[model samples]
Target: MDNDEPLESKTTEETETQPAPQSSDEMLYCEAEVPTPVDKEKAGRENSETDLEIEDTEKLFTTGQKELYTEACKLMGVVPVSCFLRNMEESYMNLNHHGLGPHGTKAIAIALVSNTTVISLEVADNCIMEEGTLSLVEMLQENYYLQELNISDNALGLEGAKIISEFLQRNSSSLFNLQLSGNNFKDDSAELLCQALSANYRIKEIDLSHNQFSDKGGELLGHMLALNVGLLSLDLSWNHLCSQAAMALSNGLKANITLKTLDLSMNGFGNEGAAALAEVLRLNSCLASLDISSNDISTEGVSKISKGLEFNESLKVLKLFLNPISIDGATLLILSIKKNPKSKMENLDISNVMVSEQFVKTLDGVYAVHPQLDVVYKSIQGLSVKKTILQWTNPMKLIQSYADQKEITILDFFKSLSATGAMKMSAGEFWKAMTKQNQVPLNRSQLRELTKRLEDSTGMVDFSVLSVAKP
Candidate 1:
């Protein structure tokens, strides 16, 4: 054959070797072909191996956790062995020591209650170190359920505190109460914590007692307090906070309206700090309780507080215990009480303070002078007389006559009338009428007869009988 004829023949052979283009239906049928039995078996075997591997890994993790827990329980000697397998909402095992080293404990803590809502773990008096605290903080950051955490007395120093502060800053945790008391957190740690608090609004209460927080830490905390509206209580007792810290706290208190209770006891808040706090108290309308006990507060400091008390009506409890407060301070406090007639104060503790007998006597006198004062005195016959004399300055002969009778104290008479049913009157109405009448005191015999008649008449006894002579 010629060369051109040979090439044409080769092209023809190539074309013949190429398969023809199939129709759309033929393509669809080819694509829909099912896998062979061997391929199906191979796929199923691979899937089964994957499932087994996953199950084995899970079993290994679980077994490791259980072993750790058992070891921890044995180390801590916690009785009634409580083991949680899954779904721990709020785990409160305060003071329970699991003998795991810091790392192991933290791992278990994170694993055991990884999905908890609130973790109140009190490792007080434990020897937890920085490494353990860091691990715990990492777990906290990863956790979504934990809200309130109490890790007090873990011996975690500034380094550990810093780690926790980092987590607090990043996590939008539901944690509201964070107690770091007895942790020896110094100024740096405190500042870190305050920074975290300022950034995070979830925490409501922070206890920093028994730490080394000095003026710097106090200043930071105070600044945070000024801006934070969520915090309700702040305890900085025994922190060596001096006048500088007190001044900062005072400034913060002026801006803060949500904080109701503040504890500054054992902080050495001398006259300066006390005066600063007093000023804050004068302006604050929400703070209900203040504890300045065990400080070096003297008469001057107390005078400042007393001055504040004159303008403050919200403070119901004031503690000035273990201070150098004397008669002068007491006198000032009594005067403040007198000036502020609308004070709703329930208790005032100045115990262990250098208060003079004269101060007590003055307090008694002031107590006697209050318009709503109720003085309870015991008689020689062991009978208690509660006399709530009104502030009526007018001299009425009828009241004098009743006072001379000395039959019963005003409270006793009212109580008897109430018990006898003669005073079908409600407590408010009876007090109103009694108050309106100026409480004409009656002699024991007359009071007794009145009560008896009141009982006999079921609170409907006629008062006209008192005008008649004795039978």
Candidate 2:
């Protein structure tokens, strides 16, 4: 959409003999590069201190911005509709510690508080540390009109996160999107952020990626993920989430149906974690895009993820870039896709996979069968043949079956399976089956705990006493 190619010419080209369907030859095909938008007015406008209650006007404006005092005076009470405080020169992710200083942030905060029409605020990459964040929260508390907030890439440490989290709890802020990515947030800080995320129902998209989170963030992730149905996308890439953390998120995601895009790339979630997430995919049908690239996963993890693909119908984009999935892993993924009649995946990225030349030839054959789908890999050849794509299955029809069974009845049925004079079974099998049957009124964690308790190696006795009642 950002391309400058004329629509008329594109239409005319399409009207002409339609080009034969082509498959992707390169790993990165048709990757559209969007040129960054440059606002001449904002770029040229001198950064002078806008009219605010704060004193010291002389030191407020930088020497180069001294002349813009007249313009600043005119734009007094009603600042503007959208505020662009982002440093255009710096890359989005490159922001380390460059942002509006405390003084500048404070001044802007004071002015923005009174401005009722100001909807969106973008103050990213300005090293607005704790002091600036405190000042911003002051605005967030009073001004409910502000909808979008971007204070990303600032080295706002633990104190900053605490302030923001505490402020969010007190006030009903109207923010729909929050960008706090690469803020050097610690585990404790991320824990604080989870509260804000769960409370803010208006929030739809959030970026907490590259925060180096640990158990602190993972502990409350299930509750956080479960609370936000409005959220569409979440970025937690490069957060160093271990198997425990990954499992926590997977359990949370078991009931989530709104989140569409998730980026968990570079986290060290091994096969165990990936397998747990696969179980999540069996129940969730809303997530459309998923990225678990560069997580040091092996064929086992890949196989588990492929199994998830077999059950997931909404997923369209999968990124497995720079992982240790070899030819065997690739085969598992391919076979899984082939098995799933309801898989909606159209784009798959498998760059840097360890595969044989024969496997590459196999992909060529797959391309010949499914030319429309973009299957990107290191060694791929374009070909045109019969249309092939994963078709929808009867899963949507069976969705009601998951909920239709009465929880109490299912609990009793499982109890009967291991009851007096019935088939002698392990306590773990009975508990596992009971949990599977009792999906309602119980979160994934609760079910898992029951199953785990039953799995105790000491040959656990009676699970009939376990309560699966609605809380």
Candidate 3:
């Protein structure tokens, strides 16, 4: 009987007396004994209650919704989403990029009036013009179930803004989130919307990016932010807010207490604007996140912001990516955060900017004090000191030319290079892609510079912006 020797087989009688072998599934429920009569009765009652609850949930979609769905399907020449008809208990309906034009949008709007199950709805990039928006506004006025709505890129210009403004003015508490980006809303429409927002107090978040809002509109909206007490998040990126406008906005934010997140990226907010925002940061304690990437903020502006960061305790996330703030500016930020012993700062995004070794060492020391703080960047001190054959040139033109030569849309080109099938790619990935192709004829230094020039606060290059720039 050596340890490695095989055991003998059991006798037939002994095998018969042994317990039966159990499968994995049986082993899992080995302790689950047969229920007693009383236990069975309790389980039956619980199952009956669950059945009744399910039935009630199914009834949330009423006969009215069925009739509306039928009518809408016929008018739109397409079946309504299963969430409306079949899965009547669903709370979200996403119809983004469905090519639902004005007619289809109106038909859907008519059906949505009776939809009590849906709480969040998305109909973005559907080509729903002003006519469709009018129908939606009418539906929104009547329908009270929807709490979140997205109708971005619907070509709903000034008229649509006015319609939405009227809705907001009247709406007491139903809607909580809104997305109105790329709607061509100008200063006048912005003023009207701001006035409406000022009066209404239910909306918690809003996106007004890619619009035509200038200094005047920015001022009005800033005034609205000062008065509005319910808003928690506001995005005004890719607009025309300059020094004066930004200063006005910052001044207004001094009095606000509820707003937590603010994005003003891709604006003309230079050093002057940064100086004003510095004042805001020093005083405002409610703001948790602020993004001002690509606002032409230089070392001087960073100095101002650094001074603010020394005193700021509530701000958690700061994105200064794509600014001309060199290593010196990054160092200032690190020192500023370190100086603030009570700093609640969590994320500091200086992506696409090259940092010096000294700056990196200082950031490491700051990490000792604030273990939760994250500093995001792509390039190091070596890249900053490299000499280039040619002076810095705009790579956007080359990218556009490459798209043309490839005989594909700009979006398609970017999507082809993107690993996630999105319109954006990381700076490192983009540079690698550029190196593999002669379509974008540029040297290594140029490629590195291109990545830095295009990347946003998250170190992502959004190539789809080129498509929007096209006619």
Best by lDDT: 3
Query: Model 2, which residues run further than 4 Å from truth?
Result: 1-99, 114-120, 141-146, 354-372, 380-471
In candidate 1, position 177 carries an lDDT of 75
lDDT, candidate 1, equals 0.59
Q: Which pairs clash in the backbone of model 3?
A: none
Q: lDDT for each of the candidates? A: 0.59, 0.60, 0.74
Q: Give the per-residue lDDT digits (tens) of candidate 1, residues 202-298.
A: 7777888898888898899889888877877788888888899899989988998798888889987789998998898789999877888888989
State which candidate has the highest TM-score: 3
Clash tally for model 1: 6
| Sliding window of 10 residues with minimal summed lDDT for model 2 | 74-83
**Residue-wise lDDT of candidate 3 within 103-178, one digit each (tens)?**
5566567667666788988888877887668767767766789899999988788888887898899865388999
Worst 10 residues of 3 by lDDT: 1-10
lDDT of 2: 0.60
Model 2: per-residue lDDT, tens digit, 209-297? 87878755775766689876678889999786878888889877876778988999988888887887788777788887889888778
